[model samples]
Target: MTDIYRKLYTSSMMPSINLPKHYNYIGAFLSLSCNLSCSYCINHLVGLDQRRKHLSGAEWVEGLNRIQTEGPLPISLQGGEPSIHKGFIEILNGLRKDLNVDLLTNLQFDPHKFMDLVDPERFKRDLPYPSIRVSYHPETMDLAETVNKVKILHDNGYSIGLFTVAHPDALEYIPAAEQACEENGILFKTKEFLGEHNGKLHGTYHYEGSVFSKEVKTVNCKTSELLISPEGHIYRCHHDLYNKITPVGHILDPKFQIDDIFRECTYFGKCNPCDVKRKNNRFQNFGHCSVEIQDIE
Candidate 1:
């Protein structure tokens, strides 16, 4: 007797997760387990729970298909490393035809296998950033190896880019690494290191006391992001996400709805840097923030 796997719910059965008008990002945390443990990962700054259950590839496909969106924004697949998910390729192939996707990885996975299984067109999109952003961690990964993998993927039609964080410890090594990537026809960029390094906190935040400040206060916060965890739990912010705080809703629930309004947060001072960081919006505009915080109480 043969059997077929069934989806938990159909798109029709589930309510649409209407995205906000000014929403800048839609991040889907496919898996939070990384092969290389970087000390500066923001997820760990707020205490990440890696033991949480990850939704199966089919479940992820079913859950994400219910999202209602428009414009240049694509559902970003990220994590400790999104590629580590056992069903990573399947999830890529399973998203609905209308939805495009992006990936943030460390380039540690088998690129050849990825190329063989995934159609690069799935991630291709007309955007300022590449569909796949590979991080080059000099602390744990070899730069030559990273560049080679990226070159191969790029040569194979994958829209890929390489980047590194300018952590104080890692700064001296970036110039050479950038040269290597450029030599191979790969565009490399650097991101601001946003965590503690050698006893001093390093980051620029929009909120006065949202991150790295030793102050904890209550405030009304609104998010312009859809932060889904590995288990399909949607959270208000990255702080709530890494800490595994109460989620707004579960993706699989028929009653799940997205409230793009400010909600009370007593842990405002303890926010994850990602939430309060001043960064670029979807249009590549400067000075974009993921959450709006007001009504201090």
Candidate 2:
């Protein structure tokens, strides 16, 4: 039997997902299962349950191709470790040509095999940062091995870089990674750690007091990015996506659509800092927040 798939579009046709009209970004979680289980992994704290079924590669391609967005903004392939997905490269090359593609990976794959299968320009762009971002974990990863892999990919003309978390313990190693990357002409940067460590919270969040606490309150929330879970479920914020909380709808259901309106959420205090934080606006400039929350009830 030939497989048939559905498409998700506007709200009038089907179920509504509160989203901004102009989706500046889209994140497709190929799989929330990662090889290395870091203790500080926000996925675990955010209520990311691995039991959810992951969509097949074909389902992902079909679902992603149906996104009707209006911008040069790319669809980011992310997750516990996006590269670990069975069809990582296939999904990367499978996206619509009009839609730019980006990746957030740990660079644990074989680079030679990746380069031989995929073209360079698929991830290339005239941007301030590299299209492919490799995350560096000092405790769970070896610095030398990670750096070597990054250098190999960079030398091959692939637009790639390194991003390390600024954990309290890892902060001391950030400068070393940065200097190493700079010496090798690699773009190495740090991302603020979101969860609590050593009894203190890190990261600059937009909504004050919106994490870890058991407090749940109703609030109106909207997002600028298109967030998809490993099961192809679309959500309004990282809070919903990671927390296994309420999802607006599923992608490629044809019945699923973007509402482009603010909706009521009961998990306000438990919001993911990534969604509530006021951070860079793609240009690496500060003060750009991912979600706008209001009507605290």
Candidate with maximal TM-score: 1
Q: Note each model's CA RMSD in angstroms.
A: 3.1, 3.7
* Model 1 residue 202 CA deviation in Å: 1.3
Model 2, residue pairs in steric clash: 6-252, 7-254
Give the per-residue lDDT digits (tens) of candidate 2, residues 1-297: 013433334324433233344566689988888888777888887544558788878778867877765546778899989988888877888877877788998878889898999888888765577899998998888887888888998999988999999899888888888888898888888888888887887888887777766778888887788899998888888877876678887786775677777888888888888888777776667888888789875
Report model 1's TM-score to 2 decimal places: 0.94
lDDT of prediction 2: 0.79
**Clash number for candidate 1:** 0
Cα distance off (Å), candidate 2, residue 52: 1.8
**Top candidate (lDDT):** 1
Instruction: Give Cα-based local distance difference scores for all models.
Output: 0.84, 0.79
What's the TM-score of each model vs. the native?
A: 0.94, 0.91
Model 2 stretches astray by more than 4 angstroms = 1-21, 46-49
